[model samples]
Target: MGYLALFAVGVTKFLLGKNKNEQIAMDWRKNAVQVFRQEFDHVGCNSDAQSLALMQRSYSEYEYFASGRQNVFYAEANLSLRKRHCLFTTLLFDLTSQTEDLVQFNIPLNLPKNMPLEFLVCRRKDLKGRVSKLTNPGNFIKNPNSKHFKLSEAEASSKNSLMVLAEHDEISNNLIDQEVGLVLAKYGSLINLIHVTDLKQYNNFPLFLRAELQLTSESEEAQYTLLGLMLRLADNVAAYRMSQTVVQKCEKSRKQQKQEEQMQVKQAQ
Candidate 1:
């Protein structure tokens, strides 16, 4: 059979019948407890929820929550194979803020500060405007506090020179630049892990650096890497907000806690 057919058969087999699917899905709910763990009693990926809750493809988004200084950050993605996303990664970070979406900065290995680095600023078209120079430091790159999600892939874990190929590879997503953007710069630290995208629909959430894996490779590293990034992002964002920010912080709201407990009731029904 074809790949698509094989995938469907695999899912059906894994899920079994509707009754059995519910059992498996319920297990997802139980494991949904933590998308990422916390060092302290009240931090980490406090929640890990899959779309199987509703079993709807439209809702096939994974909601991984990380506590921030002020609010909860959600790292979402759809692992559905039906979607024709090349390499099939649709990771997005929801800060749950109103920050307007802008620029999709495709980073390079070595980024110098103050020099002209081609930045695809906020302008939606046929991906027009061959650009140069990064003006908005907040978006392109920002000075991080002592705390930031250590993106290992961008550095070593995913192998050194991880970004050496990113500039050349096509990130197949609507929010990414159709073409690569590289330029010179000066006085910029290597925040090479993340690239900003303009795909704003989920409340001004900034998508973070994804763990890119080969489409042909069936290794679970991609999943692990994606989750790791989510956790790191959660840590970085939460830490940044608490330290550099003054707004409200994510404190494991009572409502959220109750909802998690309610999941057990939901499974019973």
Candidate 2:
């Protein structure tokens, strides 16, 4: 009777352990679902059906957040699932503006310690132009501000270079002609003119009106007025085209010079 009681107690202990393990597994699955839903909501997944499909395919297992820690867990399983579906696992933390001053957070987690990362600080509008300037400083310094002027001075101290103006807008023929003459006198290069052809009906109204009036048998007086307007437009278009060609040629020359310099440096090295 003593041996049988001992055996029954051992069996009860085994069953209790198994039940506890099962409960833990259930909790993990539930937590994983919750975490995925929260992340999905944070990322605005509802707006896109494709994103929702990605989430469904990528959410797999919930690894224990941390040993003995209920709050944190490894998103490794979900990340792997996402990778299989060609989806990026981006973790975005909601940080308040004041949080940076108060909290310490690890940057670029999971990346190699030796990996190089570049941070660019600038107004959003200046990003493209600043990048272009870094490649070709002389051509980029058309309107120099205090910051750029300092940069220009540094460049000048290092190398003798000429500053060139950016291509002029050619929406108006008269403006193009004026810019072309100025460029020729200053830089002695053909200026490239950029004529933007706006396709909107309202934008082309003046030209369209003249063409229609001329084609219609409205009156001899109307015909004469329309013809004069058409002649003026033709002259404007011709002038714009010529200026554009000149500017393009100048730009080509500048590019060729830049290429030659690069080749010279390569040869010297």
Candidate 3:
């Protein structure tokens, strides 16, 4: 009789322990997503209680949020010291009402409130898998050797020369440093450095081809056009800076040439 009573107590203790562990796991997951949403401001429709509730619920445990043309799936998992937030979105065709392939989007963090969120769609599964690693897209340009570029120290340090760094290639940093060092030796402060990551290799279609198709008068054209316009603006800014530098160089060269000619006439006299 005593043995039976002890067995009952042991079983009760075992069940309680299991329940406690489960609760701890659940609490940890909830806290994680909450922190992520707060940090990234990933919440949708701040004014709508229903939308907020739906987002919380969906993000609570790998669920989908759909409204009209947009569909988003939220997934959260604990990794090391942080809880990773992964959200995937797909746009459904308004005419055919078919869901498109999953399009990768960006979750903006550590930026001004008015700054627009930036997103990129890549076909690379590995890149998609590493979305969590991209906590800051703005800093990607600052770090020449970021996963988005294959730049050498030399190329990265060039003051004003535009450098193209292929993200997917394995280029030696030492070589880049050497080349940039050589440029610095000649043009001390006249070098401009630029790093561009072409994600076309990760896309289903060639980037130019996809861009051409996107320009077609389709419903998604507006989004594509906006993206193109942003890229164009960045290019324009870079070109303007380059043009100013070239003009300065030309003016300096003309002054030097005139001085040399005067010196030659003086020697003749």
Clashes of each: 14, 6, 11
Better of 1 and 3 by TM-score: 1
TM-score of 3: 0.20
- lDDT for model 3, on a 0 to 1 scale? 0.29
Clashes in predicted model 2? 6
Badly placed stretches (over 4 Å) of model 1 are 1-54, 58-73, 80-193, 196-202, 205-217, 241-269
- TM-score per candidate: 0.29, 0.20, 0.20
Per-residue alpha-carbon lDDT of candidate 1 for residues 75-150, written as tens digits (9 for 90 to 100): 3332222221212222222233222111111111211211111112121121122112212222222112112122
lDDT of each: 0.27, 0.29, 0.29
lDDT for residue 2 in candidate 1, whole number 0-100: 100
Error of 1 at 219 (Å): 2.1
Write down the worst ten-residue block by lDDT for model 1.
179-188
Best by TM-score: 1
